[model samples]
Target: MDRPRRIAGEVWVAVGVLAMAGWTLTEPAHPAGFITWAAAILVALGTAAQAVTGSLRWWGGRLCGGVVGLELVGAVGDRFGAFGRPGSPAVSWGDWSHFQAEAAQLVPWDRLVVPAAVAATVAEVVLGVLLVVGPWQRWTGKATAGLFVIYLLAMIPGMGSASILEYGLPVLIGGALVSSARGDRRATHQSPAVGRENTLAADYK
Candidate 1:
């Protein structure tokens, strides 16, 4: 992406982080929700930092990915009654069952909710670590792109317009990262070809 667009995307991501924080703070009783939002904020801030400073882009990408992985873990934990407190209605088997039904309606299959959720959550954590700490970043970017697609599709049926409004840009941002990473790989591959052509020209001269 061009510099201006990159900066704009970063700003949007930062704004989303702040918005999620503001929304979460209004419900102080929901600690699990707060934690998830905090992770999302970290991701947004990290990605924004990438746009702000080119030298730290790798760090920023890793930070965002790491936090996103945490968010996924928190989501999985929340599903299993891990976030419940004594007087709070945080854990509800009934609600979870209902959610399963909803998810089934959106994307129906055998063992849809548990299996899909578990798989996606695990993948998110793994991909996040790879993005942050591993050398295979282009693959990481592709994995992230696929994960975002799944998330967007899964949420849209239930969340409707609100989900789209909140998440659409993130999906776009993911796509941008995938495209840019792929472009970098292509450029790297072409370097040797360019070098060979340069040597051939020098010989002719």
Candidate 2:
């Protein structure tokens, strides 16, 4: 955590989004919902500021680490009552089952999910490894950017504004790495090239 501020900001923003969702679900509570919503807004705003100012790259390692951490924590939570049972996840259990059933009805067994699921899962795991190991940040950055696009595609099929709000933000954030790449390139290109020392000639003589 080279930059503790960035990690705090990013984590806070994620939490803030959660808080906002919770607040909205229980709208117009006598008084306290307003406070929760306000706090959410502040956290997200702070994260955005840090992200845009180039002060949060320290969280690069944390970003990769977070991918695994969140998944581990989620898997563990679901094992208990924290996330409800297998057939029904606590939050959107009904919708989840409905979607699966609908997809099953429409898709044929032989022609269905195996290929895509395997390919995508493999890619995800490989990308996660690359991200964690810091093997090639450029390649990883580009891949992450592509994953962001894939997420947007996921949202598009749903045809919901809420989906866009919930998922598209990550795509925007992924663009941060792309932006960093371009900035690095520009800085490299602008620096004076090889041994061309053209100092002022003999003015003091």
Candidate 3:
């Protein structure tokens, strides 16, 4: 990315991280809350570093990947009642049964709900790990994007009651991951060619 655009993106990311940090700190005191706040701070620092050095590809992939990975894993935690009871404000589904119930609302077949919920949970965990670890980003990013697209379509039935963040944010982040992956691929393809050209020019000089 160009310097101006890269700086602008970093600024926005930093602002987001700061906002998350602020929110996390304001939440009821809990060990997990502190951890989340710390993570947000780290991301903010990473964003600042990238802004100063203008290293978007390296930092950008990790930033986007880390944020998405945490979101997926944290969601799974919420479903498992890690944060609070199922019906509590902090919890989403709250347990396997609750998740299945929600799945039933979206799944056309009742028999498919259990398996679908299980598969989704497993996929989210695996994808979350892959994204956080930074291996196979191109394929993982593509997969994440596909997953979010599926989520957006599934939520159409409840769009009237759903918050914009519920249906929109994930899709936006997924698109960013896909775009970043493509940028990485292009950079990979051009590097060796650029290197070869530089070597030949030096030989002539």
Candidate 4:
């Protein structure tokens, strides 16, 4: 895609994600949440596909990374009551205690809850940052896929009623593809000599 079209696609995908996030915070269990989530995933899937198959691979990677990063940070914020008061209808897992209660259902051992929650929180922030400001997109993307897979498996006991699958599955697929795809060759392989020449020309001006 050309630069303008590529930018438009990225913005569209970002808006879709933000819409889903907003809807989720206000009405996580609402039936419409599924529709919005699915629609966003569809848009994301198309953009990601175009990126992988065309010259926009770098842009695609950043898009996926940004979405995932924002999701992680936002979820962490929700856990800490950043968006709303704990136990309020406007928020999900409105506080750390509330989040732990939800986590307790997925964790097998009582002893593991605190440690697991702590580890997961720390991982989310670190990985989220790395994904957004990536020096290693490929590895970070794979790690993100792994994290989502773990979450999916943890939800198996409630698979019959799970809402996570609506977004989780697509994210897993997107993360895998982002990990495997190559970045833009021209951007990665630009000559240092050419850059130095540009610097010299600017200096003389």
Q: Which candidate should be chosen as best, given TM-score against the real structure? A: 4
User: Candidate 4's residue-wise lDDT over 68-164, tens digit each?
Assistant: 6666776788899998888665466788998888778779999999998898899888877876665565566567667866776787784433345
Clashing pairs in 1: none
Candidate 1 vs candidate 3: the lDDT winner is 3
**lDDT winner among the candidates?**
4
Arrange candidates by lDDT, descending: 4, 3, 1, 2
TM-score of 2: 0.43
Which should have the higher TM-score, number 1 or number 3?
A: 3
Off by over 4 Å in 2: 1-56, 59-112, 167-205
- Kindly give the stretch of ten consecutive residues in candidate 1 with the minimal lDDT sum: 178-187
Off by over 4 Å in 3: 1-54, 158-164, 175-205
**TM-score: the better of candidates 1 and 2:** 1
Model 1 C-alpha lDDT versus the unseen true structure: 0.49
Q: Scored by CA lDDT, what does every candidate get? A: 0.49, 0.39, 0.56, 0.59
